[model samples]
Target: MVGVMRSCLRSLLKLMNSIIGMVGTGMILYSLWMIRLWHQHLDGGGSISQIPWFIYTFLGLGISLCLITCSGHIAAETANGHCLSCYMVFVFLVVLLEAAVTADVFLNRNWEEDFPEDPTGRFEEFKKFVRSNFEMCKWIGSLIVAAQALSILLAMILRALGPDRGGYYDSDDDYTPARLPLLKPPVQQPPYAVDSHFKLKNDVWNTNR
Candidate 1:
């Protein structure tokens, strides 16, 4: 039972590590993609204002940094056998920072002055679309942060429970209760050599003879 529990805990830890690593790698890749896309847009005669460029650049850098931090945490956990709580906290911080940066980017967009050439036509339509999309992005960012926070909280709880509660890795010296022995079936005996009265009947017949 102890061995099984330990195996389960190890598997859980590995799964968590893999998930965080993938998320971090994805973040870095997405940031690079966004930067590349923006550059392409600029090259294609799209008049991207300096403000949006700055916002994109800032967000890209922030996401890159967060990914780096997450990677570092994962490496540290792998190398040092540290508690998963540390990684959880790191992830939580990264999520919170991401949320803040996203909010800032959306808020800093100047819809009123954007595309002034077409006063109530193209610019208004574009502004409405941007506003709606930005709001959606903001909600998405919030949900991501919320999910990260929940994961961190759960990791902390599992860490607190230790290996005894089927959490965390246990060392060889860890105390585990001995498993109870399995019950064995009762042994069957051959049928009695004869009925109880057989010996008495035999003795009476011998005396009569």
Candidate 2:
């Protein structure tokens, strides 16, 4: 029963990591697309000299998340606790960082109003550009943040309450006897000790190991 539970737990963890991987990859691809869109906006005489910091932030976050999730997935497959410990620490830090960034994107007024007004209806074009590029990223970033938080929670639970058994489970067939070296007298040493000086004098039995 314990083994069955452990198997289920591992499967669940893998599923969660797979979700993380997918989301992270999606964010990365979207960021790249948004970057291209921003470049186009720049070429069209848009006065937003700076792209939103959140674009680069999302890229960094997505890469880190994908790598960390992959590492955690592989580590969870092992019985070693150290890997899980390290992974948990990373997950905790990332969760904090992601939450903070997500909050900043909304709460900070500077980002939304950074662009300058153009007199020849360019402002309207830029507004559409911002809405299209920023809105998708904003929503996706929010989702990714929530998903990362969820990942952290699930990872913590898995780390704390692992397999139903205390440790790894193994069958009787997996057990093997330990091999110990057997000590024997050196082959070159004769069974009886001989006195070289007095050729006839010799010990009854040799004691050298």
TM-score of each: 0.40, 0.55
Once superposed on the true structure, which residue ranges of model 2 sit more than 4 Å away at CA? 38-52, 102-150, 160-170, 173-209
lDDT of 2 by residue, 46-125 (tens): 77744466667668878987998888787668624666677777878877876675566578867546533433343455
> What lDDT would each prediction earn against the true structure?
0.54, 0.66
lDDT by residue for model 1 (45-161), tens: 877544444334445655654564465445333322254655665676677776675566568685344323431133345447767798885675565555555556545544554
Best by lDDT: 2
Candidate 1 structure, TM-score to reference: 0.40
How many steric overlaps does candidate 1 have? 0
Model 1: residues with Cα > 4 Å off, grouped in runs = 1-30, 37-81, 95-130, 164-209
Q: Report the C-alpha displacement of residue 130, candidate 2, in angstroms.
A: 11
